[model samples]
Target: MQGSSIAVDKIATELWAAEVIPRVKDAVVYLDDHMAEALHWNRGLAWLLDSGALAVRELSYFESGLSKAEEKAVFIVGEPLVGPCLSRIAAVVRASCFTCCTVITSCPPAAHHSALYGAVPQQELRDSFLHVEEQLLDWMGNMNFSTTVIYAPLALVSVAPNFVIMPQFQDVFPTLPAPQNTNDSCNKELGALPRHLQTSIQSLVGNLCSIMNMLNVKPDVFSLGQTSHFIGEELERCSRSSRKERGLTLVLVDRTMDMAGALTSACDSVMDRVVRVLPPFTKGHSIDVQVDMSSLCAASRSTAESGISNSVAPGCLSHRDSEIAMHHLVTAKQKECLMELNRLLVEWGSRNGLRLDVGGRLTPQLLQKRVNQFRGTSRNVLQGGLLQQVLGVARALSHPGAAKLQDQYGAEKLLLQNAVANGGSPVVQLLRSRHSMGLSLEDVIVLLTLLYSLVGEKALGDDECLLKAEIVQAVYQAAEKDELPLFLHDLLRENVHEENAVLAAVDHMFDVLPGLGSTADTPKHRLLLECSNSGTQPAVYKPLTQQLLHEILQDDPTLQLVHHAGGLTDRIKSGFGFFRAAAKPHPRDNPVIMLFIVGGVTASEAKLAFDVVSSNKINKQVIVGGTALAKPQEQLRLLFQRQFR
Candidate 1:
């Protein structure tokens, strides 16, 4: 043979201070690349190269930090995870289940054997999270494999209707590869991540998916394709021969199907932040989310204006302006929401070790102004945006990913219920008031206008301008009651319309909601939010009372005897059908501000929820949350059911 060269995965490099290389007191001549290369070129020169750098990533963690290509970091699996000892010169990657600690080390021998290998399966485990196939755990308790790393993103795999048929986790583990961006929505932009970390995650997720798919039933074409274990093992052998320092990442998911953990009732808790706060159209770093309402109409008049630079609008000037105003309002609210969340984070950081950026804090006076601006902007985004035309986006997203599982009709029914329950436009509630009755023309107009404003447009109703300011003041007066979401249902219903008089609320609602829209061409979607017994969550993803509003709306919007109340005729005759008007906060209910974080949540649904929740400016709510606020199913199950199964 003429020549052959084998390249190792690891390479040593020098560290520079400013631009200068520092002198070492003591050093091992592990690598002399020139000689190594020369030896490769000529086997006769091999004796000239004495040694090379250590391949132990763990050892590198203890040595001073080196250029990324220089040091290998070790993987740790223990408490105080990534602690000072691990973080200090040694670069360490730790893999762990957030809802657990010391998985293999926690239990005693006999008990551990029974729990891990015994025939008895934990009820809660099967009910709350996904069940672990007997074969997968066999590798763990049986020690068939050493230091196995499970790689499938838990959220994806955990969502099957039945576990008895789902592929085993072990079959998915060994071939584990890193997660990849299957599409724009997957959010896995490789270049966006640090090089080393990127490869690690990709390998982890890819391997898992590959192995899992090789078994029983293959994933759907529209779904994440699985990788095989044989391929995984081959790759492993190559890596070992190359003496690669393999680090690991383990992602745990619990929510599988939308039905079992219906996330629909989370409008106040989740969705609003996404539409208004996240603004998918936006790009780059700064929150320069300025949208000129006047330009919106121009975009629609001419297709040239509808391009990316224009952002939105493809119709009449007024409609365009309306949409633009919606964007402007949403942007304004995001800043304010950011301010509010920053305040909470700062306090939390003070209590803990996290020191949030000082600039994010809002003073008491500025806070008041920010709140007003945010609420005003939110009102616009809700009323003018595409979602406003297509009603129930809030209800749909609030339950993250629920709309996907159900058929269109099923989805519509769910949304209709949600609209009604949230004290939907007067039209919906009115129609719902009497099972056989329908809304009058005037009622429909008012209802549509209300729905528009609720999405993100300027409301033309009683809560406008100074009236709104007064209502806000009144809300503060009875702040305690506002948090009691149940009491706010009537207010949410009546004021939603009353808040926007000029917009012809009911018609606008039809324009936006899927079933009510003018065209069959518009793809229809509905939400079927359900939580299964196995999703190891401690409580509902949101407050129980918040969810009840949609239930109430879908049930009945009338109190019969009264002209508007949703009950019977006798009560209406006695003014029972009428509800007391209280645009301003009263002692029974006050406006509330909430904070949500979805940092731990893995699904795009969770990230989108964060974006939606961060944009709310509703009368009774000033909530903020996103990916960071999402509580994992495991955490919920632990808190709700001891998470022991």
Candidate 2:
């Protein structure tokens, strides 16, 4: 894991030095806040900007500070879809300044082209591209500065650039690549797909090649899926000669092919607990919790005889402290930890003549004072601001409303498991009593969709069918009322007709490795039991891809290195057979394995790849990269929008 971090940092730094630093001089940098935060760009940017390479006047967020500087500037845009906005911002900034401006995006030119004209009909794609090009040229001409556009197509966290976390484009265009237009009689069928998808695929392939070049990885074998055969061919064309000694294998898979793993809710994991209680995991690992300092001060005053000091102000806690608190809150086994901390706070406040309530606000001073008071104890519960934050999160999670929602989530999970294992009646009765479950209508729909994905139409009984219909009707009514979008109706309909390939894969995975789906109390049930048992809180979830890779690489003998020209679907068939191969000795002591997920990857999955390689579990160094990092909800929402809109 440490090695992975080092590698990622090295790559990000090298890329920054090579592309960004040399071009930036006495320029105001407009940073895309979202991308910066997601990719942990601060570290690299800070090192470069602070190192005196570029005389950066000021750093500004993309939305703000565009017109603040009347000087040459560098605009780091997030993606090509935001080209218009970026152009507008640059135009506004240029109006006030006569200096040249350079626009650098984390996406390729193809992404921008795709955004502008990819959706047009194949025949009209050229005209649309030309129109967009003309508009961009006109816009640039009006600006006072000479504008240059550079495509970085690099979205990686400074801490793990080797993982190469890409954006989840498939979520937006769920039915993309338009299947294989099999109507051979029609000439148009040959080029039925929108130009954008093709360009995007090419850009992705290009990005992969760049990464390979950066890493100096020459694989002896390429195991690509049908959708990604082009990547293999490109790699083959680029390779000078194969080095079998390295024994590197590249595995590329489509997200749709593994929907069950991507969409299924994690059971009994730290991620599950955190997601159930806290806000959704969007782009980053941190979450903000609004802490009421005034209330806490008031509570402290009431509890302690010595009036609490007015030095502590009311505001949100530090992000670092809050992150620490959240980590402990999610991993904590004893709920009483929060109560104990709360009790300690009140006790200390009372001793200091400060009045406090049971659910009072927590401040740094209060925490420090408590820590000082408990210094004599062997285990300092109030060691850091973490205790205070943990108590805050606990209070929120323990709320009646939050507790009820958690129960509903658990119930939903059970329903999914039961449906998949026993083919039981759909939980219509439970869903109908919505008031009792305290679940939102959207939650119900999501759960039902999950079940639909697993069971398929043929497996669902009459009662289950009726339940599904009722849920659909409710969803439709919500859509009519604008609580839900009209597209959801189409999404639900399409979900019902989805092929059972994902389901079959899920069954096969569980059959081969029961521990994966095991709910047993054994250590095998949890992926990172070693970390947990060692009293170290894991930074991220054990990635599903890592788990799958570990299982496949451990003592698998039948699998031999082979170069195949098939797509993801074909590769999956062969891959599983290879996984099922008996354990055999390898030629090399340590081999190189390359794993790529086509649609997108989660941060947790990326971390797991690093961990596995660092642990030397398979006695091999693994290089993992993906198309993007996307949340499950985002993926589902994208699918819905694609189907309906």
- Residue 72 displacement (Å), model 2: 0.7
Model 1 global lDDT (CA atoms, 0 to 1): 0.25
Q: Which ten residues in a row have the lowest lDDT in candidate 1?
A: 6-15
Instruction: State the lDDT of candidate 2 residue by residue for 203-269, as single tens digits.
Output: 5554555555665555443432334454455454444343333334566654443344444444222
Residue range 229-331, candidate 1, lDDT tens digits: 2222223322322222222111122121111122232323222333322232222111112222322223332244222235442211112212333222233
What's the CA error at residue 361 for candidate 1, in Å? 59
TM-score, per-candidate, Cα-based: 0.20, 0.60
> Which structure among the candidates has the greatest lDDT?
2
